[model samples]
Target: MLKEKLLVLVGPTAVGKTKLSLTLAERYDAEIISGDSMQVYRGMDIGTAKATTEERARVPHHMIDIHDPDYPFSVAEFQQRTEGLIRDINGRGKLPFIVGGTGLYIESVCYRFQFGQGGSDEAFRAEMQAYAEARGAEALHARLREVDPEMAEKLHPNDLRRVIRALEVHHLTGERLSEQLKGQKKQTPYELCIIGLTMDRALLYNRIEKRIDQMIEEGLVDEVRSLLNRGYGKDLVSMQGLGYKEIALFLEGRCTLDEAVELLKRNTRRFAKRQLSWFRHMQDIQWVDVTDMEKISDHLSEIHAIIAGKLTLDR
Candidate 1:
């Protein structure tokens, strides 16, 4: 039984995964499938740091801008779409590369995670949703942390849907979703090579700050304004994403613009910390620390050599 080959690139945000991924994909003549949960939505380019027009023109990318901002996309849906894309890319004699910082989405594809079928309690779910609306996502997430620390660690506070589902699973089955996930086999039907990028925490945080400032300059606030003007409310999951939610608060007069930007920076830093925590526990990842690299090209060369040893190519 021949297995398809997959190259996975994952790391915390603002870690220069994008430039490195493009270089690697271009070298291997591969297509990219975004492992990001947010990049799939249309009209979310700047905030998500989507590949630029020239970059996409150079190498085909899949799983980006495929859905409306209000559309619901589960990890199951992401896994299903990624499975098909991998098969088709391999069938066409091209390599498939998965790139993003979304740990669960990436892990679901790499490990072939079988989502559990713990029955739902809609009434309970609604109650939890209302609780979140009243108190806040962070407060709701704290409840999850108490009940299921492992799942809470993986979830962002703003990920209300998954957070509620975790609480609901615990309520209905009297078992933690994380514990149920432990019973599933950790095996994949593909040859997967996962590469993780890392650097000094201080430097990475500086990068995050700079990235947010760049996003603001790139018109992220205007982008949020456009979405809201088109009736995409803050309630939409996409609007609840990092940049969108903060900017939406400013637009809605809930927070001053300065306060919103400051909060965006603070929340984004916290999110990056969580992302690093998730990757730290993952097994079999080749971590590359670019703490001293002055240019992306330098990092690209090191990554290319690493991938060349890990993945076989038909030259």
Candidate 2:
């Protein structure tokens, strides 16, 4: 049996995935499904760098603004929703294009990774949360590193939810979360064409910094403040996202606006590094160097050629 065709564009934050995705989706008659983890929350527009209203008017997008900030969106839920969206988009005789920077969420869909169904321990989860609150997120992450260094390496110390989940997996099943993931089948159920964007490390970092600055200029602090005013606590997973957390500190008087901006820039640079590292480990990505911004049409043509050759799309 033949598999459906799926097109994906992935890269670190501010590597120009959004611009490229819009052009590709328009050219290929595709509907985009956001592979981003944070973009799903409502009212997180400017900080997540979500497509503008005009962009969405040009082409349909999915899996964005579909949840409240307090909702606990897992990789499993992302996979399920994306699969459904893919089918629906394909049924309409259009391509399903996934575009974002979230690595694990995208990879789980691409490879059909089955997360282990170890039952949850509420008390254990609460205790872990308490430990993080008391000793700091790094201290909690250290406990996971003792058991699953590979996973600990992939997850940032500030990603307390996933760190706790990894520890919980070990607590319940005696098997490392990384081991469980490694043991899953690698076969994809699609004729997958993944396009990875890259650029010089220094240039990419520069772009990330500029983008964070732009976000601040575009009222990113106000966006966070609005969310907070609406009763979303800082501890919520959504509030803990890259820009939100740092800016929330400023709003709470824990830091100055300048300090928060600098922190957001620094953390985002590290995040982009981690995103690139994760994507490097995945196989069959047709990497494209997009450092030359002046020749974007040339880059688009190259990507079009790759999609045409790989997925046999009509020119």
Q: lDDT per residue, candidate 2, 112-132, as tens digits?
A: 888657989999999999999
> Against the true structure, whose TM-score is highest?
2
Q: Candidate 1 — which residues are off by over 4 angstroms?
A: 295-298
Query: What is the Å distance of residue 210 in model 2 from its true position?
Result: 0.7
Each prediction's Cα lDDT score? 0.90, 0.91
lDDT of 1 at 259: 93
**What is model 1's C-alpha RMSD?**
1.4
Candidate 1 clashing pairs, residues 3+ apart or interchain: none
User: Best candidate per lDDT, number?
Assistant: 2
